[model samples]
Target: MRITGIRATPVAVPYRSPEVWAFGRRRGQVSVLIEVDTDDGVTGLGEAAAYPSADIVLAVLRGLEPLVLGEDPFAVERLVRRIELVGTWHHVKATSPAIAAVEMACWDILGKVCGQPLVNLFGGRFRERVECFYYVARAEPDDVAAEARLATKAGFGTCYLKVGSDDPRTDIERVAALRDGAGPDARLRIDANEAWSPGTAVRLIRELERFDLELMEQPVSGRNLDEMAYVRGRVGVPILANEASWTRYDQLAVIKAGAADVLSVDNQMDGGLANLKRAAGLCEAAGLPVVKHSLGELGVALAAAVHVIASTPNFRYANQAYGALLADDVTSGFGGGLESYADGCMEVPSGPGLGVALDPDRVARYAELYRTEGASFSFGDPQALARAHALPKL
Candidate 1:
């Protein structure tokens, strides 16, 4: 059926605790929910992490709406290509969230039309459930150790520690505590969030080599491929590419440069499932494993990631910052409870489509927040607003 209309609503859901990363603290999660309506009376829902503003949503609608308004929603590839024609050569970080929203919605529509779950549509499940890792913020060594124990007790197989705050000694102590707390069986991973330089990463990795970390993620800045390769060569542990690599094109460069051992794919940042699949395929061809990057997403995208991980044969590592940790998920916030993870594995949603339904009442509540104080359309001062507006839509 043809797409009849596209609508976007931004929402702000406050977090139980401030989400602290290397970047900054997020008091609330801001996202844009996209609804795609088709002629056959079928509607698809998608959400994207709304940053700085809802401009990405506006850009996607302004660019893709005209081309998709009268076209078949099933022609997702053609729609993506048309949008790409107007999109920048390199993936524009600002518009990726919007693209992710639309792409996810389109996948939803396809699943409904096929009368199958998105996972089945991809191929078939290699595994019925996926293992998950806990995302712990940068905190004191004692606090981090406590959190790690909680995650392991909660049935998570892995715990991801956020590093790169200040004081290398403190970071090292935190990692050591987590490792000690997790003991010998549980997997521990560290994410520097591009906080360290090559020298610092080398020094830290050397110091923490005794802990047996599963991997180190984005230890250095993503921009310098050569430096990343250099770090990879010098370090003993497996270095994962998170922000440093995204699409297949980016992975190709990383592989050619021999930059990283693992590729962390985020559906939100990597243009949704289509590009994620491509990147996974590339990683498989290159003998590299795939891991999912967390973006504080809700059930819809989480389901999509489960489908990808289940269908993709090359994915090895469990994704971090997922499942029960997210406080304001539309699905679980309502009545749709998350699948329980037992002994380090979470069962995929068995229902049709993305396997979750949105609570309209909850959506309305958050939508009002977006329209009021939570709406952020520009990042800089007053002058930047005009410049942002002048940028081509999509």
Candidate 2:
């Protein structure tokens, strides 16, 4: 069937709490959702990372629609290549999410046409359900501990702790409380979001060792693999790299440097679901445990992550942040609504494609939010916005 039209909807969903980063709290979560329409009346759903600039992504996606108007949605590679995903001509940083959203929607159309779930299409189910973690945003030390208790009671195998406070002492105090509150068996992982230098990361990690962290993520900057490798060698905790690495290119650089023990891959950052599977294959070859990373994503992206994780063989941890963060989502009608995380694991949506359906009403609500208040970047740390603009010529 020929392609018809493509639309990108901007969504603004409030975080349950101020999503703290660097040293402060963010106002809310803003994302751009993608919809690809075809001539046979088949449609697919997808999402883009909307921080820094959602408007630009929307504009870019709109401009690219004509390139895909008459193509086969099932020709996934050709369609992805039709858009600039890499090299000097690509704008993957600002538009990766937009392109990824479109790519995922194509997969949705492909799956629906073939009558199979995304997990089935991606080489069957490696695991019917994937383990997940509850994310504890930057908050008071006591509040962080309390949230860990609730996550543990809910049966989450691990809980995420975000570290990057201006005061190093606060990080220590918070770690203590979470450890004592969650008990011994519960795994604790911390993400610094590229906030420290190698020396500081070494010092902070050494100090937090008594609590036995699951892994210290992105402790140092993403720019230098050698710095990350230095911290990894000095510390005993397993290190999982995030912001510092994206594609197989970065993954290999980090691996060759012996920078981290684990790799965290996000579908949005890696381009799309197919690229993520390739990154997983890279990890498989390296014998490293790779997990999914969900930073400020909405339901459509989270559901896409679930499908990829379910199909990936090297995914071996309680991966991602979702469910508890967003107050509401723009999709519905999966085996359960996308908010169905329970007992430390989320079952893959058993229906066709991404296994989630978009609710027109909900989409409109978020779409309106974007129209009114979606113009600027407010991801807690302002430097991140600057870093985004500094993306290399490509």
> Local distance difference test, per candidate?
0.75, 0.78
Residue 188, candidate 1: how far off, in angstroms?
0.8
lDDT of 2 by residue, 1-394 (tens): 8789887777777667767766446666787877888999999988887744677777878767767789899998887776764322253565677777788899999988988889888888889888878877778888988988887877777888888766689888988888877889999998888878787888889999989999999998888888888889999999999986676678888878888899988777766799899988898898998988875677677777888888888899888766666667777743122246768787788888888888889889877887787643256566544443321211
Model 1 TM-score? Answer: 0.89
Question: In model 1, which regions exceed 4 Å deviation?
Answer: 86-90, 332-340, 372-394
- Alpha-carbon error at 225 in model 2, in Å? 0.8
lDDT by residue (88-120, candidate 1, tens digit) is 423776677777788888889999878888889
Error of 2 at 371 (Å): 2.9
- Clashing pairs for model 2 are 222-244
Residue 184's lDDT in candidate 2: 95
Error of 1 at 82 (Å): 1.2
